[model samples]
Target: MKGISSYADTGRFEEISLASSSYSSILYDSIRDRPDFKAGLSEQAHLAAKFESEAKYSVLNGFSYISKHVNPHKKWGMLINLSSFAKDANLSLHRNCIYCSKAVDLNINAMVDNNYNTFYVAEKTEAGELGEDIAAMQQYPVTADTSVSTLLLSNIKQGERAIIVVPLKKKNFSHCMNFIHHAGDGIVVDGQQNKLYNFNNNADKKIFDSLYGAASSAIKPARIYITGKAPDIRNEAWEMIEHPYFPDNDWEEL
Candidate 1:
């Protein structure tokens, strides 16, 4: 009796009763006439009945208790801006720049000039903020070895035109295409060998229209170079704006 266990805890009593009911209705003469077996089955039927009654009361009480409380979804917001990107960029600076005495002074000016606007769907965490905080929450910085992806993200805004420079990395060709698709408004500048790639024909046409004017603009074409092949460094010549990759699907009206 100690080793033999009951089905009370496992909820199998109800299953056995259901099977008994089905068998009772079948044309199995031998199964229907078994009085001793039927008498033993009465214990399982009683357990199932008790379980159902308790389950009903528990469910009703649980629902009533839950209905008395307010269930509010939590909100989250992030203000990511150029400053954070610069902080991240500092980690990637060349060893020589890190050692130079002028590094601090240079980064200060770079930070000031690297201004860009980022407006995004606000999370509950961002509620009641204004001005700079509103703009900062939308910024996303680029990661190491992802300059092309970073640049493409920087150039795009929801429903706005952008001229992006794609950095050349033989390994990240697919990442570049994904960045283009996410932008929803970007055009490849011809004659830039470093950062160009093939996009889906249908998607490319849409990007062409988004960048129509600037695509034809007379401004000096932005050069994209494979990482190691970046041209000679000039003081304060390179400008960087980094932001997070926001998907059009997740976008909500501000």
Candidate 2:
């Protein structure tokens, strides 16, 4: 009874119209000689018609929702810069050195000296409701090729510090830097050449403080250059800083 009423409200012609004309006619003729039988058949026919209409509408609404919300064909590109670490001799670039290296096995430092640190690059494609999946991707070696290169060496010379320069794609460099900081790696403080230095472990704290002081006093600004695009999560996670360099459109297909 409830289903029949719902069917009437939705106005699904396929269920009510066809049944009312075809099936109802047959039932009516068969029960014409008996008033009780005819009345009962008509009541069942109305309920059946209503149920059919509701089913059709429910299916159509479900499909519409999926089509609007599901991003089955969406794609984006992730460019990672493994170059700086790849060219550095002080850092260990071996496969067993970094976390998750065995699983990703990018061999990014192979393009540069073996002593360099290895970084990762990835591109991703998203499906309906599901997150991104790494598609065609690669990694390359990166090195400080600018005047601010001194900042890197100076931090290393300080003995317990490692200098990291994350370049801003545009004016909003803080957004990206904050992401790396919150990831539990370290705290980012101002450094030379627009670069920020972060220290994660207790051992590196002094290094961060010293670098922060030195960078603040230095006349030359630090340069933060990335060899490749960072991962999707890293990019999205950092909302404070906007990557001016990130392209406006997605390019997962390429």
Candidate 3:
């Protein structure tokens, strides 16, 4: 698990020990055995409702209206940000609370929109191994990890092509969970070393032409890269992850 950094020396956040891996049985056990896990999940749900209510109120009243007098927008934003951190804490338990679970090697990422303070978590899995049960967990009220939708945006420009590299190691991605609360832009890459998957950007191909040109000259190319404008790349990525279809199975709910 990743260490929780103190925010502005306020010391509001503290680290809790958690299970080490996200194997299926371990996830099941944590939900069953860990009182803290269930308690945190419930707390997260509570915060989600509060945050939603505040957001809905702000939308109806106008953020500018709140910002003008009491600055409730800032206050609510900070509260929402804190809830984001709380969600991370709860998610950590889900992913790494058990002592005997096997490590699942894969990557998952959430694309964020800074302007709207929104998160779009990618629905990544380990090559679909026993994934149906877990995928359905997102929809089941009892099993949903609320943090999936509460974290920070990547602070990306509306049209720029950005990549949040999600390595196989869970620790590497854990810290990124709180990127929004810390006011940081999560990893932005040019996609040089990482293979660009599902390209939807329409940028100049020369963006990567030089790098690939040099690589191909030294060795036969294993794959080709292309670019395009990904105006809705976030939506596309989410749709692919949340509604994954394996010809043999349909979308099953918990």
Minimum summed lDDT over a 10-residue window in model 2 is located at 1-10
TM-score of 1: 0.17
Against the true structure, candidate 3 reaches a TM-score of 0.18
lDDT of 2 by residue, 164-196 (tens): 322222211111111122333333322101222
How many clashing residue pairs appear in each of the predictions shown? 7, 15, 12
Residues 68-98 of candidate 3: C-alpha lDDT, one tens digit per residue = 2211122333344454447553222112111
For candidate 1, the clash count comes to 7
Error of 1 at 239 (Å): 35
* Quality of model 3 by C-alpha lDDT: 0.20
Model 1, 1-254: lDDT tens digits are 01111111110111122223232233223211323212211121222333334223442221112111111111111122223325553211111110111111111112223311211111112111011111111212223323333345354442222212222121111011111222232323221111222222444444333322122212211211111111112232112112122222221212
Candidate 3 segments whose C-alpha is farther than 4 A from its true place: 1-34, 38-52, 57-173, 176-254
Clashes of 3: 12
The 10-residue segment with the lowest total lDDT in model 3: 99-108
